[model samples]
Target: MALLDTSRTAPGKGVAPLRSAAKAALEASGLPGRKTEAWRFTSVRDLTTADATPAQGGLVVDAAPGVDVHRLQGELPADVAGWLAAVEPTLPNAHFVALNGVLADELVVLHAQGHVVAPVTVTHHGAGEGSVSTPRLLVVLEPNAELTLVERFGGSSKGLTNAVTQVRLGANAGLRHIRVHDVAQASLIGALGVAQERDSRYRSLVVSLGGRLARLDLRVRLEGAGSRCDLDGLYHVDGQDHVDHHLRVEHHAPHATSTQTYRGVLDGRGVAVFDGQAQVTRTGPGAEAHQQNRNLLLSEGARAHTKPHLEIDHDEVVASHGATVGSLDEDALFYLRARGVPREDARTILVHAFLRELLESAPTPLRDELAAALRERLPRGEVTAAMELALDVDEAKGDGIEGDA
Candidate 1:
């Protein structure tokens, strides 16, 4: 049975020329199911019936100064097959990638050949209720160039947003990516695909807070020797919110290294899932890969599912992956309580301790914003001092992160 009937559907705005191929890809992969190894634990129901209209009731944000933000305005290249062949052919068969290729709105392109002084920011705000928005971003960093890119998504509207980002790094180039999303009970699906060249470096920090339904998939390939990638994420969901993180890292060249660290905090009846995989290919003999997923559940109703995978097809390589799901540490809680702290304060202390590492490691500009966002979600005083104690409240007096929402 076909996963999707791409028949009778005209090609979307940007990918008009590749309608048939896109449809074929959709049919080949179909929608993943319980039996699908990659998607067995999570459900993408919200995305299958995904709406493509603009969302309602979200703040319109601004990009940093002097950065050119333009639409894909022109037609795709004539030799589209060559472009498709640049990336893996399996892209179409991946979850919603093909559908996105056919349905996405104009893609936003960010290109730089030299070092950029300030970070480039992209914002996704709600346009109305039950409306959907598909945003696409293409980033290219020429060899020896460096830049920072920030992605922010926030809104209270009831809608769905499916976003895709494609990145290419030339040899010796570097990139820093920071993505922060704080949504209401809305549906969200996002995918990021990256290809790195020799000696290139890529680092990403992702923070996701309470959402109705949210899923983020990250696929990174170290295709060049000595290339490196570092991925870190923080997720906090409560009140029946559902969030899932799917990550895959592939080491296809020798002397490559990849590291992943993700922490999640779930309370109320909310549920969270983390599935991360690391692959070391035969060509990658001197590869080093590490992954860890740690989750904390604050209430009996809260739930978490975690899976960490490592596959090595090389003779000389080092790889490790692990997942931990448990409530606050009772020993630490007891220690705090014995020190005269109230029960609530003790719990808060333990929770903060669990999250402190990633929060503190976040980019400087976004740290305070993250602390504020987390504080707002917790019941007032769920943590003693909430803002002042857990985070550096004294410093985050500014209105926002460089006009970010």
Candidate 2:
């Protein structure tokens, strides 16, 4: 079926207006092509050609004690309804989000009021062949509240998953979000939009492990003074997998701060793309922004494209951006090999080290899980023995070691 065809689908309960608006928007924008600035590096050919029918997948939500989980059946929460109405027409490359409105049966809203120690987890399982799953999530945090959220996405190889998550942070509120995408053979197109109020903080870590075609569009806006945001991402792709990350952080208020750090490991014929931009508007005079992206190409057939940009409109702002795409450290590999480590094991050690820094920011349990996932992708060898040997080398240099060696 054509991705933009809405004739076969009708609005679900309580979402008629949004569905109508989205249908029109989808028709106007159509599918984004390579010439489109936002999709320059990532292609939507798979989406355009897929014959998947709209399918409603189940969501398993493990909510904390102080949090509220609501599924839209009649009318959406006022705030969430308004947000969906506002973003449908303005979000860049919003084809998938608009399509979501055209097909989704209901919206999931998670609300937090006070400090919550436990994390809220949402998991999405894969759909069947010739199916398309569109999941929508909205997270709202009240003033002075704090919470942690985890999202996991997985799907069948012949299916497609298109999801959108929106977050609204009130003044003085904070949220830590971790998202893991492990759709081994399916295609995933996801978007995350966050708006922070005065003194609110939002920190997120994204780990993309598997997908035939995976892409994430992350946009964060610092709208109030003293608001801050930090975005860290890691992705490992191999065997013809394609992953793309497009990030934009807007500093719209004085004293707002933002930082972005991303690392990727690519092997076989895997393709990875990173496009990040930091915008410091005139009103954000005291804003500070920094961005960096690094990619390790493990095979001759692997390809990585990185672009980090800064748009500063005020002289009082401090901003910097950079990106690097290269192979492993030959010296490090040689050092490990000279220590009696085999070639394959040495390569694995160096590859793990390249991604260790980013993983350090993740939660302990998540860090270990991601480490194991990374190990599974690298060349198989005596990883444990090689790690011990590599640690000894680091100690010989009098450098204290951290993370999985």
Top model number, TM-score: 2
- For every model shown, the clashing-pair count is 8, 1
lDDT of 1 by residue, 1-405 (tens): 111223334234454534445567777776787787766666765545644443222322244543455455336554333333454432322647766565554656566667777877778763345565556666767789888888887767666666677777889989998888776866677788888999999998888887887778888988899999999998888887888888889888999999999998899999888988888878646899999999998889988889888988766988788889888888888888898988877776667656657878566567766766776666544464553543444335554445446
After superposing candidate 1, which stretches have Cα over 4 Å from the reference? 1-12, 17-21, 46-68, 77-93, 380-405
lDDT of 1 at 2: 17
Q: What residue pairs are clashing in model 1?
A: 3-30, 52-132, 53-132, 55-126, 55-127, 55-128, 56-127, 56-128
